[model samples]
Target: PLGMVMGSCVYHIAHQRMGAKIGNIGRNVEIEQFTQALYDARELAMSRMQAEAEALHAEGIVGVQLRQHSHTWGSHTTEFFAIGTAVRPLRDNHIIERPTMVLSLDS
Candidate 1:
C-alpha cells in the first residue's frame, strides 16, 4: 500500500454533576440545565488537551475528534469525548539521537 497513517483513536469521557437529583420521569423539566452542564464539562476536557499540546510545543493536532453522550444504567451521568495527536516540526540534524525535548509517543 501507499504511504498512509494508521492512527489510534482515543476517547475521553467527561462527566458533569447537575447537583440536582434526577426527578422521577421528568427529564423535560431539567433538559436545559443538563445540557449546560454537559457543555461545561466538554470545554474542560478540551482545555486540558490544548494545554498538554502546548507543553510539548506541538505544531498542530491531527485526526482530532470529539463525542458526547449521557451515562446510562448504573453510571447515571453525561460524558464528552475527545481525541487527537500532538505534532511538532521535524528538523533534519546530523545528530543520531534525538534531543531530550523531542516529543515522541513511542518514548
Candidate 2:
C-alpha cells in the first residue's frame, strides 16, 4: 500500500498563502475561502504523509519538513511537500512528547 520511497535531510519551505485573483474566483469571496483552499490542500498532503508513515510502520515522523507552493505564477496547481525521518519509538516507553511550561509569576 505504498509507492516510491523517500529520503532524509530534506530542505524545507512552508507557506500558507493562496491568491485568488478577482474574476478568477468570486471577487466577493471572503478571505477564509482562499485560506480554506490552502488548508484543504495541506490536509490532503498530510493525509498522504500519514499513509506513508503507516505503510512504513513508523511510530512517528521526526525532522518533519514542509514545503508550500503559495505563489501563483499563472499556475493553478499547488501542493505541499513534506519530508522527514520516519521512525518507530521503543515499544515500552513510546510516548516522547515534550512539555513546555512558563514557570513565572509576574505581578
Candidate 3:
C-alpha cells in the first residue's frame, strides 16, 4: 500500500545582539542561536512525519519534500513542513539482489 505522510513545525526567531563594538568599529558575526533554531525546527518536522508513516505501518517513505513558509505569522516566525509518500512492501522478508556487471568486448 502507498500513502501520503506529512508533518510540520513552527518556530520563532529570538532577538540577539547584531554587532560587537571594538574601539570604533563594529563586527558582525553569525548568530549561533538562529542557526540552532532552524536545525531544531527541521528535525522536529521530520520526526513527526516519520511517526505518521510508522502509524500507517509503512516500511519506508520516499520522495520526501521539505519546505519552509511564513504565513500570517510575523517575520520572526517560520513554519517547517515535511511530506513524503509511505510505501509498504508487497511481501514480507523480501530479498533484494544486486545487479551483475556486464563488460563489452568492443570499445
Query: Which has the greatest lDDT?
Result: 3
The sequence of per-residue lDDT tens digits that candidate 2 reaches over residues 46-81 is: 667777788888766766666776446535456677
Instruction: Count clashes in each candidate, considering only residues at least 3 apart in sequence or on different chains.
Output: 2, 0, 0
- Return the TM-score for candidate 3, rounded to 2 decimals: 0.74
The digit string of per-residue lDDT tens for model 1 on 1-74 reads 11112222223333444564444355546455555666677776677666667766765555567776654642
Q: Compose the digit string of candidate 3's lDDT tens values, residues 1-107.
A: 47899999999988664453242255466667778888999999999999999999887777789999876757777899999998776777874343367999998
- Report lDDT (Cα) of residue 88, candidate 2: 69
Off by over 4 Å in 2: 1-30, 71-73, 91-95, 98-107
Best of the two (2, 3) by lDDT? 3
Better of 1 and 2 by TM-score: 2
How accurate locally, in lDDT, is each candidate? Answer: 0.55, 0.59, 0.82
Q: Cα RMSD for candidate 3?
A: 7.1
